[model samples]
Target: MSFGGEAAVIGSRRLFAIHLFTATGAALALLSVLAAWQGDWRATFVWLGIALIVDGIDGPIARRFKVRERLPKWDGAALDFVIDYATYVFIPALVIALGLHLSTLLGAVLGVIVAVTGALYFADTRMKQPDNSFRGFPAVWNMAAFVMFALMPSPAVITIVVIALAALTFLPVNFVHPVRVVRWRPLTLAMLAGWLVASSWFLLTEPPLSAGIKTLLIVTSLYLLCVSGVQQMLPRRPKAGF
Candidate 1:
């Protein structure tokens, strides 16, 4: 009956479609969950990978469409956060606890810690800084899980890494959001792209990522982890994310 939709309040169908596109990430997360439950690690990550792509693009697309003005009824950011928690925190926690070298009980406990802390981290109002950099570790368990799988570290080491990263959740360290963080952005994007390439290769091939590819993942992760320190070096006391 109208260009906006069947109802005037429905807003532009084209813009509403973008919000719906963002919502599809939840469906992808569900697929990832099922794949993880089946112990198909590769398939699980593949689904998560697709979901990640969706999460990465939806924001810019929504902005490009001025979705907020066009579709005032829906909150894209909140929807994105909900889908992100599932894909970035919950499912990755599930995969980590499932695939780690630890016993079922211990793994599950770690998963609970990850899930709980990650949820809390997301709720922190200061989670994002003025430059869009994360105020802390950002609870990107998906990447952590990927690194753990690629590295295949010992159980004790894996446990320690998990615990340490969880502890770092509330720390005042900075972590870059590849697409959003601007300083050294070219390098940041390159590292992000390198990670995607290496990880995709690892996923496409058989088990045991090649040493070189694994090395690439590690190097990229290290850059991401320490990039904040680089920023901090510029100013004695970097401005707080708040």
Candidate 2:
């Protein structure tokens, strides 16, 4: 091949590698499931956490390398959605069952709700808006459930939160995407960093989250939950083409 063609081939290979990297999250998700099956909660969270990191980084890397532009045949977003459903919805449902020690009947019912709503949300092309914010709750059950795990909230409280969030999935309200949302991005990312650190401490340590870390986590969560609501009420800028 000519030098130019050789360079093009190398670049394509790099893009493919990035796709492979994103696909690894599926493996991690499976590992998480197995870990959870064994009642190895820590290991489960560890795998999910690693998968979370992979999910967070791959998008930027893909965008930076122009993966979509170069590899039009590969549906990176679709691959991501599959893994995301595992880590973000399915596994979290399992965790909710195990973590809360729910009866099998209860767990199955709730899990079905999570999986069904999550699948619908994923298939919704209007899930994300032009501003890079989610059109609804975004179905981040993993984080929602994880926070509940850390806090060890009452089962009733947990059920209420889960049901409420699932309902929010269909709402027209906006939810921020942290890295993707442009408004207050720096501050949002800073809060996200704090949340990751605080949440990591909870995941790494045993149950009975410390007062300080729990407070930090709560603060960050409230910011994430409320910021977009505030933005929703403000007048909209002209929607930009994505």
Indicate the residue-level lDDT of 32 in model 1: 90
- Tens digit of per-residue lDDT, candidate 1, span 102-220: 79998999999999999999899998888888887898999999889878899898899889999889888888988787777888999989988898999898876778998899999
Report how far off residue 222 is in candidate 2 (Å): 2.0
Off by over 4 Å in 1: 1-11, 236-242
- List model 2 lDDT by residue over 1-242, tens digit each: 99999999998897899999999999999999999989987788889889999999999999998888889999998999899999999899888877666777776777788888888898888987988999888888888877887787776787788788888889898899998888888889999999999988987777688889999999999899778878889876677331
Cα RMSD of all models vs. native, in order, equals 3.6, 3.2
**lDDT of residue 117 for candidate 1:** 95
- State TM-scores per candidate: 0.91, 0.91
TM-score of model 2 vs. true structure: 0.91
